[model samples]
Target: MSLWYFLIDWFAGVPTFGVLFKRFMINFAWVCIALFVMLVFQLPAEYAAIVYFGFIVVNGVMGFVFLRQRMQMRD
Candidate 1:
């Protein structure tokens, strides 16, 4: 409904605002987690960003592995 929300929905091709809201929540959670770790551990905040970015890639691999393992178990 709002301008920025409209732009995001249009750009993402999502028909409902709920979908956009869900995606934003997930992304924001990851960012919060990264920043929290950085602050609590006294590590460089940049590495937190780097690690969060890496989460995208490693998540795919882990998902694939879990899927494959489940498929194999069914046989």
Candidate 2:
């Protein structure tokens, strides 16, 4: 990668992963809120498990996507 590419957060003149990170963070925050709500409301164990698994799945997907993008950019 060029110095400019290393110092900047764009790819081919377009904004890079900041947007994707922001979106993922927002969704993560919502998942956290939902988990907190479930706890506060004493929701069923099954419901809590579902939400927790959903969070795990989302995290896994986001990590995969980020790594894929990074690999693509490296080339």
Give me the displacement of residue 62 in model 2, in angstroms: 0.7
lDDT tens per residue, model 2, 24-75? 6776798889988988999898997888788778666766666777778789
Return the top candidate by lDDT. 2
Candidate 2 lands at a TM-score of: 0.57
Model 1 score (lDDT) = 0.62
How accurate locally, in lDDT, is each candidate?
Answer: 0.62, 0.69
Q: Could you tell me which 10 consecutive residues in candidate 2 have the lowest summed lDDT?
A: 6-15
Tell how far residue 35 is off in model 2, in angstroms: 2.2
- In model 1, the Cα lDDT at residue 48 comes to 79
Residue 26 lDDT in model 2? 72
TM-score, one value per model: 0.40, 0.57
Residue pairs in candidate 1 whose N, alpha carbon or C atoms collide under 3 angstroms:
none
Model 1: CA > 4 A from native: 1-13, 45-75
